[model samples]
Target: MNLIKPHDRISLAEKIGRPSVALVVDDFYNRVQTHPTLAKPFSIVAHWQEHKQRITEFWWIALGGKPTASYSYDPVSKHFLAGFNQTLLSDWKALFFEVTHTHLSPELASAWQQRVEMIGENLLRQNDKLLGDRGRPST
Candidate 1:
């Protein structure tokens, strides 16, 4: 009983809205903060409040919305600076997909995960350089 179909691209921002997006981001970060392997890399980020706010805006714009100033940070560089390795990135992706699938419809989750995988690929290719976001910048 899915509302979406193949080749049907909808506005995820409109589908999920800001509140749901916030909830997903909160849950994702909260889970990551407590993860045994992932927690170490994120431990340097003491400003969880601000990080969550910026990340929420990042997802909002990424999912399909007007880009806010807060969403302009380079995620790949940030992760590299946080000392994220390949295993950490893989675990992070797994956790992200788990959290996203929990919050979004299957169709929406698939679409978002596709974008994330592409971004992850580009991030690996760029090697700590800025890959930027999906909506405004090229991956």
Candidate 2:
């Protein structure tokens, strides 16, 4: 079965551009490092620069851009190991949206934000199944 991403081939990365993707990733993580609730959950990352670069690629691919590198991602495993919970995921999403709005125009940011919400729901489900952390975000 050829699995297609839910957002399909919209090429949002091309529309939003590579530089803005990097900007969002960098800005989001930079805030995460100091976020009162996220500081500890994200403390697992030892290298901010490397993490940001990888995540930039992740967003690029998720937004329908062609892959620029061969780096593999296992978000479920990574999030589980990071001790992710509903609260952290919620905070992460909030901060992520905040950063995107800062760097991207309203329409592009909303488009990317919709895909990210899909990712968030998936992560929350998988993390719960693997780690037995079952809870909804504090919405």
Query: What TM-score would every model get versus the actual structure?
Result: 0.78, 0.86
Any runs in candidate 1 off by more than 4 Å, and if so which?
A: 1-10, 68-71, 128-139
Give candidate 2 misplaced runs (Cα > 4 Å). 1-10, 132-139
Q: In lDDT terms, how accurate is model 1?
A: 0.78
Worst ten in a row by lDDT for model 1: 130-139
- Tens digits of per-residue lDDT, candidate 2, 5-69, equal 96665588899999989988888888988999999988889999999989999989998899999
**Residue-level error in angstroms, candidate 1, position 50:** 0.8
C-alpha RMSD in Å of predicted model 1 compared with the true structure: 7.6
| TM-score attained by model 1 | 0.78
Per-residue lDDT tens digits for candidate 1, residues 80-125, read: 6776556776898999999889988988788878877887777766
Which candidate comes out best when scored by TM-score?
2
Against the reference, the lDDT scores of all candidates come to 0.78, 0.87
